[model samples]
Target: MLSWPDELTTELRHDLFGWCELWSVPTLADEVTVAVSRRLTSSLGRANYRHQRVTLQHTLLHPMAAALLREVLCHELAHLAAYRLHGTKIRPHGREWKALLIAAQYPPNVTYAAESLPACFAVHKRFRRPPARRSSWARLTQWIAGIPCAVR
Candidate 1:
């Protein structure tokens, strides 16, 4: 886990404000916190917290190239922007995310290259159900072990 540089945070905040301006929405408060942690075992990053309340968390465990970080930041910021504008009606990673992604200057269809981690791997499947809440920890452990995990 690595802390985002101050300059990078400033740039992202500035770009977010610019996006708000473009959409005619109020500028978001500058209180959002970006945290990186090794605890995350899913994808490269995740955005947590919304509803114009607290600092958003962006957790990145494995190494992310600079380009990947850009996408992740924009992707997370889009969630913040979407919640501010459309509340809970907006689908995550759907149209709203895509629009805000582009507005934040990432390519609309940006795809991160699979990061190489000797200790990590991915599962590929369709119709995989969400893990039962009670078994989440076990599931996560399985994932961390490089197993191809699916909830169901």
Candidate 2:
């Protein structure tokens, strides 16, 4: 079974609280939950609005991925935030989520740029941006499902 590092969990909770405060949803902080998943092969993180939980891919725990960890976590958390604020009717990455990302100072991009990521971050294989790239049809399906264009 996979588990989260105690220190990292604590830090993430602190960040979660900070985000809630920033978004003026302090009570939502306590309602939020975090989990780590080794089974997440393609995505970096996921948010379940109905459950108020954020699950992170274990790779974000890697030392080299430190810089991206917060961004990805907040990205998922923003989904929860949007849902908490707007109900289930909003688009996953639509204006509301994009506004939250902007408020958090992250680009509203759906996926991280391969060239800008750390080399060991597994941009190609894990994010599904193979050297040759995937078929346009594949990209469209993933996008329609709210998956990142490059990451599942």
Candidate 3:
């Protein structure tokens, strides 16, 4: 099986592969490429179904708790599972993806609580904003944040 960098343990890999097998996904357990990405910030993980690739924040696995790792890992992997079963035209975190998560026994939350990981906390700090901002600006920010990642 292809190893996920930064020590995503062998057991965890087996579990993920098993999930793929159980779901009968097009992506094989050994065929999926999981890598540690320096570019991932504010996000715990990302999936590119077209490339059959998953890029996780490197820090997320450095001494990370297994539960947190599984949560994030399952979350990202479900995207590929969903795409394999459905199609790319579907929303990134829409019903199809959520259903995959449910079947996989993972919470369907799209965003993770990064404060749990030290490295992710550092990334969060880099993007932290002041406590106060203009109301209009805050409203605009909320509106923009609501836009889908695939569209952005």
Q: What TM-score does each of the candidates earn?
A: 0.52, 0.69, 0.67
TM-score order, best first, reads 2, 3, 1
- Regions more than 4 Å wrong, model 1: 1-26, 50-64, 110-152
Per-residue lDDT over 59-135 for candidate 3, one digit per residue giving the tens place of the 0 to 100 score: 45545245655766777777778777887777767788778777887656544222222222122343333244545
Give the top-scoring candidate (TM-score). Answer: 2
Task: Report the lDDT of model 1 for residue 114.
Answer: 23
| Lowest summed lDDT window (length 10), candidate 1 | 112-121
The best candidate by lDDT is 2
Of candidates 3 and 1, the better by lDDT: 3
Residue ranges of candidate 2 with Cα displaced over 4 Å = 1-9, 111-152
Could you tell me the lDDT of residue 105 within candidate 1?
64
- Give the range where candidate 2 is weakest over 10 consecutive residues by summed lDDT: 114-123
How much is 77 displaced in model 2, in angstroms?
Answer: 0.3
Candidate 2 RMSD to the real structure: 9.3
> lDDT per residue, candidate 1, 17-117, as tens digits?
57657655545535445555445445434455443331221222123334445555555556666667777565555576668766666655533222332
Measured over all alpha carbons after superposition, the RMSD of each candidate to the real structure, in angstroms, is 10.2, 9.3, 9.8
In lDDT terms, how accurate is model 2?
0.63
Off by over 4 Å in 3: 1-3, 111-152
Give the Å error, residue 120, model 3. Answer: 14
